[model samples]
Target: MYGVQINDDGTIEQMNDELAQACVNGLKNLEIHNYPQPINMEVSLLSIFCGFYGTSNETISAEGIGNIRKFNKLSANADKNYGQASSNGERKPNPWILTKILRYHNKDHYEQIIKPLLKKNYEGKKKEKQIQINQTLILNKIDLTDDFTQLDMQEKAANGEYEKEEQIVMDLTRILIYYEGETEDIYAIKGYDAICDTQVLYHKLEGTVYKQLEKININFKNKKIDEKDNSKPITVKHIFKKYASKFFKKRCKFISEDPKILTVFQGYKYKKLHTIDYECLQMYFYLIKETIAAGDERVYEYILNWIAWLIQNPGKNRELQQYYKVDKVQVKIDSLM
Candidate 1:
């Protein structure tokens, strides 16, 4: 019999087309609600059995079917073995691999063997560079500048209204700087550096500023402090301390010249900042700012604690469920035709 495997959602995740055809041929007495129903049922049964029992017959023959039975037993055996291996977790296959294999076998020709023979039958040849230039012009016709400008304006407006906690902003910034310089993506940086950076930056900034103040006091008494010399370490310290609050406020705005820098401090609130790693808290702030800027009420939809909110309020919205339940797979299938 043909073999098939399905996900929990009843979507056909895998199938052995040849084996399915064999099952259809052998089980002709079974009702065909659709021309393909018997084969589909056989495959589903194979998948279910394999998943439950970890194995099934390597070969199958219909009852009272003599040696001249319609379907190929060898095909059924191979399919059954594959299904068994998959169900038992003895073999793992990527989805794409299975798709390509099934496609090739159903066509009754090896794709690799026939691929080179396929050729474009153009009546006339065009210059390759000319073709490339034409493609580039077509792609460049799309105008993204208006969208980008709108996003920027919205971001600036949101930043104008935002009031962020100083400590959270600093913590978020340092983490962004560290991970921004590293190979990790934004999400990875959030996971790894958020909390540690918060603690580290706060201490480092506090200590360095305090130490510089102490050194400046000692130098002033000895008349060694050069007021005009910008090169002096004390001068650097004073510059940092002088603008520290303003610098932090700018960092907290979440609409800096650097998008990455802004992203780091996105969600800094004094009350909630204490609970999460510095990175995630910052991202939360940024996301809030972005959503507000975009005029999207769905900003809270992806909040870290949203799942808890759903559990706390547990009446299902049937309209929302129906909206989600419309068969996206069937839509895709219909689109192909």
Candidate 2:
């Protein structure tokens, strides 16, 4: 029933070629609604599955045929464990892992199609990997995909379609600098969220897509001033009076020409800073000249709070973001067929 042949020697072997021909013959001999019908491309994958399952000995009954696609024994014992330990040593499964496993079979189907159809164009050689397959795929000989958006980014990411957020932050910082407009209604307007907004942000891009990554749940509690200074919001004037220059000043390389001077080293490697960004000195002068809340005092207070966050938490102070040399991962691509 499973398209396997049993020999007199009690050995079993696959009979795929014979079964495929038999299936074609069986369909040719069948008459649906008193009309002879021949198989065509209109035969859906589910229809083929139903035919196969209906022929199986276990699912020959009507109830068995109906329940063929349903899951049973839905209990802990039947629960097949999946996923592996994450970076933080917690076992968690990416939501789409099962779907990705199914797509793995698509590669086999793709290679089969490519051999018969695109064999002449690609010189009859099938690439071993997806990265290699991408070379031939760009020839535009076919658009087998249902739509341009058919490639699922979430699923592809699991199959190595994504880079770490930490690396992306460093890469973007080198190419673009924050420039505030000279006045209110002009070129670039700065936007902020009171809760999540720090003095900095980073963005990443792929093709026409862009994503902003930010540090969440930061320790924003300001340092107490002589016990009576409950952590209420301080004015720009109060910010200038204390905790502005002392904690910062020498640590101001974040605003300087080279931010890489801020790279804080651990035992062997630098700490990976994923989201946090910094205001540069050029932007500082830009902000002061533009003027806001009680003169340039507001700008000073923003920088002060940023510096305090870095200083107070011994974990944060690392170099300014190193976006200098372009990373090879971006420019590098395999030479395709």
Candidate whose lDDT is highest = 1
What lDDT does the true structure give each of the candidates? 0.29, 0.27
Over 4 Å off, model 1:
1-4, 11-337
Candidate 1 lDDT over 198-255, as tens digits, reads 2212212344434533332112221212222432433223433433432332232223
lDDT for model 2 comes to 0.27
lDDT of 1: 0.29
Models 1 onward score TM values of 0.17, 0.14
Per-candidate RMSD, Å: 30.9, 28.3
Backbone clash total, candidate 1: 9
Tens digits of lDDT, candidate 2, 271-292 = 3458655554567655533432
Count of clashes, each model? 9, 4
Model 2: CA > 4 A from native: 1-40, 44-168, 179-337
Q: Pull out the clashing pairs in model 2.
A: 259-320, 262-318, 262-319, 263-319
